[model samples]
Target: MKKYIAIVGSNSKKSTNRQLLEYMQHRYVNDVEIEIVEVAGLPIFKKTRDMAIPEQSKAMATKIDGADGVIIATPEYDHSIPAILSSALAWLSYGIHPLLDKPVLITGASFGSLGASRAQAQLRQILDSPEIKARVMPSSEFLLSHSLQAFNTDGLLIDAEQTKWLDSLVKDFAEFIDISAQLNHTHQEDDTRMADFSWDEGTTDKEVSK
Candidate 1:
């Protein structure tokens, strides 16, 4: 079964972005298993060259490393992503760099007309960092503007058009994850083959000295 991590950027329990992530988990949109990574308990990252990151945060990175893909639901804060999410990303950037080349899907919900598009773009920049290098899905953007109206009291999307878009996004994300994994595998195989070939062609030290 495909495994994924759904991350909500906001720290608030009543955050609409968090609600959206939870809704995705409840739906299991693409027949995949999801584990929601909560940002509330994470320690705010401090840039200290000497100190190791919080153990819990390190463990969170490890969880991300194990997942096949990540879904980041974010909220905008003055045309940018929330600080908690940025801090989490900072923590993930160092150490083992668990998010390196990982497949990712990004979405956001907000009360404004633009939803969280600007925040998502900022997030994409962070994900594109040299240490992170996350592979974001290029085509789909789930911008839930006027978020409260989009969902019903039961926490389900009410509009048929929006529902259809979500379904397609989830399906595309799943396929993207699979295809990326295959490509990584193929690259690894190629590297291994090249290494083996190089080893075979190398002369022994004794022969080289002669």
Candidate 2:
């Protein structure tokens, strides 16, 4: 069976983002193997001289590296990605590039009508950075708006239209992984660049920002 990593991009105890991913996991149990990974409890990322990262972060990176594709379900905070999600991504990329050339599907759940649209946009930019460079599914946005009421007692999506849309997106994402693999001629180049990447030597944070 094809394996995919579903990242719960929230630290909240009752995050709708996590619920959305859980629904997908249960609904697609026969089609694909979905492993839901949590971003909670990870230490905040800080640039260090030794470049040492936490073991948990390393383990997550290894999992992602082995997966066929990735699904990130995010929740908006202050109209942007949660700090915990940002920290997790930073740890995954510092001196390591498990996401490089990996095919990714972006999903977001929000309490309000906007459905984490702004945060998803920001996350796309983050994933498109030189070190990460994940092959995000283009022109696709799965926004779970009013997510609090999106699911039912059985954890299945309540609305038929929304469920159909999500189903189609998942099918498209599976095909995207195969297509992205065919277009992976630059993988070696990206790996080489990521291996050589490092924080600006001897530069203070303030100076770098200037």
Candidate 3:
């Protein structure tokens, strides 16, 4: 089964972003394994000195690296992605580049009219950086504006139009993951083939150990 990790990009217990991710987890758990993760356990990122990563951050990186794709649901904080989300990304960008070539989907819920569009846009730009190289789902932005009033008594999204839109985004994301994985696999195979002969001469012991 294809597994996807959903990240709640907030530290607040009352975060609506976490609520939105929980709804998604409940809705899609049966179809695909969905794990909602948070970054509260991780220490703030420091680039100056600490080379050794924390245990919690390592575990988080492993989960993200093993997943077929990732979904980040964040609440807009000052028209940008939350600070916690940025800290988590900084950790992931440290060693093995866990996000490299992985499929990612960015979404959010907000009380304002624009939803979290600005935040998601900033997130997409960061994810597309040459260092990260993540393949973000580009079909449409799933911004749940006025999100507090967007749900019904049954805990389901009340807007039929937005519901359909989200469903389409999920489907497209799945397809994108499949295709991206195949291409990455092909590239890795080619790299392995080319690295097999005369590849030892240019490598340091540390590189060879990996």
Best candidate, TM-score: 2
Better of 1 and 2 by lDDT: 2
How many pairs in model 1 have backbone atoms within 3 A of each other, for residues 3 or more apart or on separate chains, i.e. clashes? 0
Question: Candidate 2 lDDT, tens digit per residue, 1-210?
Answer: 889999999999999999999999999999999999999999988877678899989999999999999999999989999999999999989999899989999999999999999999999999999878999999787999999999888888999999899999999999999888899888998899888876766788775554
> What is the C-alpha local distance difference test score of candidate 2?
0.92
* lDDT score for candidate 3 against the true structure: 0.79
- Each candidate's number of clashing pairs is 0, 0, 0
Reference-based TM-score, model 2: 0.95
Write the residue-wise lDDT of candidate 1 on 1-210 in tens digits. 788888888898888888888788888746888898878778777645344688867878888978999999999889999899998887776444677668999999988999899999999989987556788988677999998788889998887887788889999998999788765644445334433432113666554344
TM-scores for all candidates: the values are 0.84, 0.95, 0.84
C-alpha lDDT score of every prediction, in listed order: 0.81, 0.92, 0.79
Top model number, lDDT: 2
lDDT of 3 at 17: 81
lDDT of 3 by residue, 178-210 (tens): 888677755565334433534235657665555
**RMSD, model 3, all Cα superposed?**
6.1
